[model samples]
Target: MPKSLKSRGGEEELQCGPVFTVFAMGTRMTFVTEEEGINVFLNSKHVNFELAVQKPVYCTASVPKNIFFTLHEKLYITMKGKMGPFNIHQFTGKLIDELHEQLGNLGSHGIMDLNILVRDLLYPATVNTVFNKGLIPTDKGELQEFYQHFETYDEGFEYGSQMPEWLLRNWSKSKKWLLEVLEKNITHIKAYKSEKDNSVTIMQAVQDVIEMEKSELIPNYALLMLWASLSNAVPIAFWTLAFVLSHPDIHRAIKEDIASVFGSAGKDKMKVTEDELKKLPLTKWCVLEAIRLRAPGVLARKVVKAVNIMNFTIPPGDLLMVSPFWLHRNPKYFPEPELFKPERWRKANLEKHAFLDGFIGFGGGKFQCPGRWFALLEIEICLILMLYKYDCYLLDPLPKQSDLHLVGVPKPEGQCRIEYRKRI
Candidate 1:
């Protein structure tokens, strides 16, 4: 039998023996030929440190982790630079407490408030995202009024004639919900009482930091927080449930891991302690694999300034995107890149490479999502509950990718149906 794999130098190599090996960038692939085809196992050494230092982003060949790590370190410095880390942590804790208390006994009213709160967090960032895309100030007032009168769909359409049809449709419904909650909640109502209120004040503070402000600030920031909650969490829950329903071995592994963590403690209750949740490694790995395969936003970078590279020059104003979807599949890095293998993450030395330039599932550099830690924890919590309690699967086969792009994230075609069964 002949076995073939890409060598470390990226050249194809063939071995007539049962096992053939290819080496590249500190990792080697050993292929064993079988009647059906070849099964390959990947092993890595320590050349990642050098490879990372050589891979260029913005024309600088710094170690990728160093770039991400340094950017985050500076973000910490700049964010808390004024108030101090302790104070920032305290503020975050306070918000977490409030959010937890509100979510604790969620009724319809509470859901409305929660939705508003999420929107408030989203508005500023959301506006900034659009504003950065060239939404001008004159456009801002009409946009604000469009959202204000959004509940009256026809009125919103009449007022927002300058906006695109899709934007108008999306915002009309969203603004109606926003107004409903803001009208109900004293906090939100007061937050934007006047153009000069604390909402604007807070928006200015955010603007000072993020460097943009439109009347859309509140809505945009609210959208940012909402995206963090919805974009990853929703899809992850769907896939986790689908995979658990279809893969019993994986399901059993997750259940056993969860059981071992909170044994006899909370069999019936949905709540588990944070420490106990961290012990579910198998569950974490399942979600990681799912996200690696399914994450929608390819990491985005815009050239803020132009520079000359070794051979050529990229002019300023060019946008650059690096996708983990492809990089994660590069046969040189992952031996069966398409296979769902969670253990790859748990294996030592893998962590060192997981967050590098090519492996940016959550994005990379200073601008990477600050809420990643919270996002991961939330995902783990939700996955544990679903894996422990329900059996689920896709009602339809995996749909082909579509053209609907929301803030660079993909939207599924219409609605997806899934079948769920109670697990015994």
Candidate 2:
């Protein structure tokens, strides 16, 4: 076991397999060494298990396969069927249609208005998803309070002004509905509060958590679920669509795949079943490739305490930022890093780009996002439908990377408009 970084007080470790990583806040340490772009303090004595509230020592922790195993356990425990409320159904399907209709009515400047429509459809659905599970009061006051505390505490926001404001505003509006749901179903949520009861129903645990931390954890956790579930899917959809429209080869391959799976002409309306979805392997690979090219948001961990790095000692309270954007695009792992090739995912290079281990799109460890399965399913369904139902193209000549505050959280730079004509 490699001596992983420890907290300043020499407490427990992050336990990323043998190589531990510590993150804390306000720990003043040089970000990078002369040789390493960021001098990650691999082993610090003070590291703890808590989501590092601040920066600890920046170091690359050896994440074992067990971390992934733990993540799978946590993911199943946290999010399984709860995605319907996060507007995955609406945002991925109806909302896109609504946005298209809205654009038809409102036109280009509708981008400003979109900030409203998107929130209207998204926030309430998100709050209710949690509230229905007995998570929190969706009341305006409760939500406002929740928003206030999260803004002050949670480190997810690197650009406070850009992301938090949007999150808070939507939260404020949806609070009342959320509260009503919680009030209606309080008893069921309480049943799952005990941590000792590993078999506790996930919904109950979620509710118990919110009920316990009405202040920070519940509200932010609810919102974070929404962000994690949708953040990559939306931008991924935008880019994937753009790619389909621009790349004739990809378009042809996908069309062939779709036709082979279902049929060729006349059958315009097709609801993709789980089995039919399995057949669209090429389409799935294309979506994956698009994510590789466009979705590379950053992940940050706060150090709960501090420890030592080499000869130098790092005090407690600091943050470590890792960019999977760089890792995902590394030429060493992905040959011709800039190229968009779905063939890479085939069995020959199955070990390429780091296994289920290095991929940060859904994150890793116990703290990884829970709704990844939902997100992936939703992406697959949406892409399948778009490719089948219509011929679409990007209005702009040069498609640019979407602006996601964090890695994989992508928002198109311009109002991403696609000219769609029914495939006849």
Best by lDDT: 2
State the lDDT of candidate 1 residue by residue for 162-266, as single tens digits: 344456565456544543432233233223333222222222343344333223233433333233434455455455444554566777687778767655323
Compute each candidate's TM-score over C-alphas. Answer: 0.53, 0.58
Cα error, candidate 1, residue 362 (Å): 1.4
List, residue by residue over 92-187, the lDDT tens digit for candidate 2. 433234223322332222223222233333333333333332343357697556444432322333433223334554433443333343344555
* lDDT (C-alpha) at residue 92 in model 1: 31
* lDDT, residue 129, candidate 1: 24
Overall local distance difference test of candidate 1: 0.41
Consecutive 10-residue window with the lowest summed lDDT within model 1: 35-44
User: Candidate 1: lDDT of 245?
Assistant: 44
- Name the best candidate (by TM-score): 2
Error of 1 at 189 (Å): 9.1
* Segments of candidate 2 deviating more than 4 angstroms: 1-50, 53-76, 80-157, 161-205, 208-220, 265-269, 304-315, 348-358, 402-408
lDDT of each: 0.41, 0.47
